[model samples]
Target: MDSVTVEGRAAAELLARKTSLAQTATDALYADMPELTTRYGAVGRERCLEDIRYTIDHLIPAIDLTQPSMFTAYVGWLDDLLRARNVSTREVIRSLELIEQAVRNELAPDEANVVASFLRAGLDSLGAVRREG
Candidate 1:
């Protein structure tokens, strides 16, 4: 099979494992930011998982279709939503960075690279917005 087909398959495989991946990533996130549990309790923990799951859900499509804009747009929208809820930009940046790290750690090199590219795109989008404000 061609490279594109192989990459698409990999992306599909990642999507199929989204829940576990999100859970693993959320575990890493909480380990890194324990205050989330102390500050927000069970509700906060669940929100973190849901947010990471939402990101993964959008991310797989972006990777499969080879469209960074798809993921970046979602990041932008998420940033807006979080900002409206009074979540700081630094927290958002840290969360995405940690998710990228956690997800990358779980994949093979090739798949990890694909995931990194999309995560970087999302981070870059957030960075540009941050620079503006």
Candidate 2:
């Protein structure tokens, strides 16, 4: 296969895996906090999906291949959002670990951190608190 085809396949696989993970996480979150579903309903799901798409489409492309420090900005953004949400740090860590595993397995060397950072940003942005941290 051509290089582009290979990369495309890898990207597609990563997206699929991440989508599955998001679905599973959402299900678990709802199971644990049924009130969240009642309170936010469809809007919450829509926002969550939008966040995922934004990360996959936009933030992933912003990574600097030669400089890992660029990823720190994304990480810090995620940290701030998570802190705002009061999302259990353990849950955030678990989700991040899953995304990192997928990216490490599927992405090219220069792109792995980008995907990881995007996942962090997406999760944080989706359900973060309205108030500042």
Q: Best-fitting candidate, measured by TM-score?
A: 1
Q: Give lDDT tens digits, candidate 2, residues 1-133.
A: 1224433444555555656645554555556566656766888756544444443443332432323334445545655675577544444445455556546765676556545655555455434533343
State the TM-score for model 2: 0.42
* Model 2 clashing residue pairs (backbone): none
Off by over 4 Å in 1: 1-6
Give residue 6's lDDT in candidate 1 (0 to 100).
Answer: 45
| lDDT digits (tens) for residues 18-122 of candidate 1 | 888888888887787788788778988899889989988888878888889999999999999988987667677777787677667777778778788888898
Candidate number achieving the greatest lDDT relative to the actual structure: 1
TM-score of every model versus the real structure: 0.89, 0.42
Whole-model lDDT for model 2 versus the true structure?
Answer: 0.50
